[model samples]
Target chain A: MKADLVKTLQKKKKQILEIWMEKQLADAGLRDDLISNEELRIQSEELVQALVQSITEKNLGNVESSEFEPVYEILAGISLSRAKQGFSPRETGIYIFSLKDSLLQVIQEEMRDDPAAMYAETIRISKLVDSFGIATFETFIKGREEVIYRQTNEITEISTPVIRVWDGILALPIIGTLDSSRTQVVMENLLQEIVETGSSIAILDISGVPAVDSLVAQHLIKTVSATRLMGAECIISGIRPEIAQTVVHLGIDLSNITTKASLASALRHAFSQLHLEVRKKQKQQ
Target chain B: MEKIPILRMGHFLLVTIQVDLYDRLAVNLEADLVQMVNKTGARGVLIDISAVSIVDSFMGRIIGNIANMSKILDAETVVVGMQPAVAITLVELGLPLQGVFTALNVERGMELLRNRIDLDLNPEDDDDDAISDAD
Candidate 1:
């Protein structure tokens, strides 16, 4: 009886692809901009062929069997590519469910003469397609996470910048929340620049930081300590009024760290520390 | 017996740690450094650890102890040429080595030691000159 169901699906593979494509094309949420109809037809045909070839009599009830490996592989590939191409989860879900609908319709028509046989085959096919839908969602989420991880690394690279503001002064403008990992990057960059430029003073500008909590304050202190260890003075500048209030409210002791209200003041302090005087040249008379 | 050498120039003592310091080596260096400071009556001590890598918590404490011991013996300690990784590790280990002065390199460390000694001796020297003139 199961063999008969597999045979029916195998025979009507072309018909299933046709119905699946029609259903997808008719849907309002179909992303025609992202995927062309011709390419969609090729992907759908590949999935349909793989599914029918894998659905043998013995493994029809077991979607997890090795016989269905090819089908799952093809589904995973399609789902991952769609995710990278910016397909919505809803659209991917509908794509898998629509294929299930097409398969069940074909089975229903072939077993019309025997209602009991049709009911049994329908349950088996539904269960199999549901499992495939789950696999698709899993791969889709994995692909999206890869995209997010890459973007996070890029942001970490670009955000922490160490600028040599003067011959003996390096300025690092931190533009984000201060975390332990970011603190490590910021500290390393500042220390290395200090070594390369022989800078005795470093200015950490935190004006772009949105908020300051105890953890961030701890990171800042750690960075300053590390800089000092490398035989340089670190001055934290661009202290927002709210951050100062929060620090005082939290009772975090920043008395040891030299902080400035703005980068200009930090620069002025650095000059005095280095015994460097930047005077405006006299205008030619 | 492996020993880290302490070189004395004028009123300052320079110790360059060229090997990775183990516990025994660090302890011996600490004892020897303090003894040398007392014996020579040096005004400043500069330690260059640029070649030494891989510092543990014990090493961090040893460095801090050396600075504190020297301070008590009337000598200023300036640690110089600390690698970035070592500095980060020391900070993370919660040993900032407070009261320890630092410099970028040996040249700067030497300059710092000279400047600190000069600052401390300037007022006393003026009094000595006035007394000599009166005599």
Candidate 2:
């Protein structure tokens, strides 16, 4: 039994070794000369690839490595000898700064926009990261803000609802958490619509909103106030029982705002007040 | 969406406001209603704002105007359903709906009206009020 166990273990290791050798040889684009001995090549290549992948993964997972720094990692592959890990965010910045510094030198070298030179530059950029490690919270938020700014100019820092009542549109169904930033955009859009539409009614349907604290409720109240000022109206709909409880718990007063069970009900109120009737569910091809 | 109970008050008109009693919407309410009255030819008025979460100073003034409008149109006016929150928001917002007809509901409000005491609420009040106001 002992001898059999040893043989099984050996066989397993041998199989793994063979697999490793095949992978590495393929990666290195090796010909017959590289695999003269299958067992030996397997043993050697597995160790090399393992070492490279570990180093790449370790850098990405390490969060303490300066938040500004972009980490790089190297991945071992069959086609390419290896791939680099993410560079520290800092490193990427540095690479760009350095490239800017080298504008004159690059022109002198007559390699302006040269693809091969660009690839080399990219490879240099990859060397700067410890790995694809965790990013700090600050970095994540900053990155998000940057993305949002690029996406919309209408969005600003304030979350107050803007109303333009004369326009006639009824309800703005807002679903989701109201981060201050998102809240600002919602306010601007709603207010403008209210004034533009001359709508006698508007509803803030937050049924899909998962949670509400004092801050969110406060924002809603502001929007309602803004709407009423224009002789337009505002209704808050989709206040789940849990959320209602939460608002009460937080000592938030929602009394002045019209609260409804759902968006349909809110719309009903709007139409009722406006004495409006339209064909329901118009089908289109 | 807030559902305001829309009932046809007898000879008078009663608007059951079902929202915060004292939200900012209450501000300039008298002017708003007066404009509506001028356009709609509404006689008597009952602003049932029981849905009011709170009442504020600005709204209190508008309520006052509703009662005042009664003299101009020969109609009676009353308000109902004032919530604690409304009183607070009104105070905070510094709104005051003074002299508006105050009632707990349509029953009490209609009881305060003469001649229409025995008659059911008339939808004409609402239609006349809105249509006249539009003109």
Candidate 3:
């Protein structure tokens, strides 16, 4: 009975592909934008070929068997690629489930004379294809997670920028919540820039920082002290009223470090330390 | 036998740590530095530790102790040329050496000492000296 099922699937492979394509095309979730119809046909044909080659009488019902490795591999690749190509989960799920419908239709037609054997074979194929659907969804979500991880790394790299505002001064504007890992990045970048530019002063503008807690305050103090240990003065500017209140309410001591209300004041303080003055030029009459 | 030398320059004493400091050697050096500062009546102490690499909590406390002792003897302590790694280690060990000053290199350290000594000698003359230096 099991051998007949595999044999029947191999014999009606072409008919199964045709029926599968029709079923997918008729489905409301079918996405023609992410993949063309011809590409979809090719992907389905390759998956079906692998599925037939891997199927055997003994392991037809055992989806976990190594004999189904090729089928799972092909399905994972197709699902992940579709995910990368921006296919929705519903579209990818429909693509896998449609195969079951096509296979069952062909099996029913091939075993019209053996009703009992056909019913048992349909259940086996249903379990195997359901397992394949679960694997596809797992791989598709994994691909999406990889894309999100890369974007997060890119954001950290872009967000922490050390700008050399003056010859002897560097300014860094932080624009998000402060965390320990982010503070490490901020400290390393600022220190590296200080060494390269030979700057005497560094102005850390925190106007873009949204909130301040004790932990964030500690990170800032660590950054300032690290800069000072490197023989360069660090001036933290952009003390918003609320953040100041939070710092005081939390009883975080910033007395030993210099802070300014705005970047302009920080710059003025840096200029005085560097013995620099910015005089306005007379406008032409 | 391995004694970290404390050399005297003018009214300032210089101690350059040229080797990794073991616990006993660090303790001995602390005693030697304090005694030398008192004997020389030095106004400033410059400790160059650019060559010393590894620092644990014990060494950190020794450095802090040396700074505190020098302060009691009326001498300012300026730790100079600390490698970035050592500074990070010391900070992680929670030893900021709060009362000590630091500079990038020996040259800058000497300059800092000179300015600090001048400020100590005549605080009222600092403004006149600064305006003249600016001109």
In the order shown, the candidates' DockQ scores are 0.82, 0.04, 0.53
Per-residue lDDT of candidate 2, residues B5-93 (tens digit): 43444355557675554444454455566666566556567776656554445556666666776557655666554443453355336
Candidate 1: tens digits of C-alpha lDDT, residues A154-194: 99999998999988999999998988888888888888888
Q: Supply every candidate's count of residue pairs whose N, Cα or C atoms clash at under 3 angstroms.
A: 0, 96, 0
Error at A31, model 2, angstroms: 22
Error of 1 at A175 (Å): 0.8
lDDT of 1 by residue, B78-106 (tens): 99999999999999999999999998999
Weakest lDDT window of 10 consecutive positions for candidate 1 chain A: A1-10
Best by DockQ: 1
| lDDT (tens digit, per residue) of candidate 3 on B1-135 | 899999999779999999999999999999999999988899999999989879899998998899999999999999987766777667767787788888777988898988888967775667766777799
Residues A1-285, candidate 2, lDDT per residue (tens digit)?
Answer: 212222332334444344445444454333344324563354344533342333232332333434222221211121112112333444323322332222223222334446565445334323422222122223434555777886554433332343333235465656557776676567557655543443456777787678998878866776666455333457888888999899988999877778998877777777767667757796887
* DockQ, computed on Cα atoms, for candidate 3: 0.53
- Candidates' TM-scores? 0.92, 0.37, 0.91
- Chain B: TM-scores of all predictions: 0.89, 0.56, 0.89
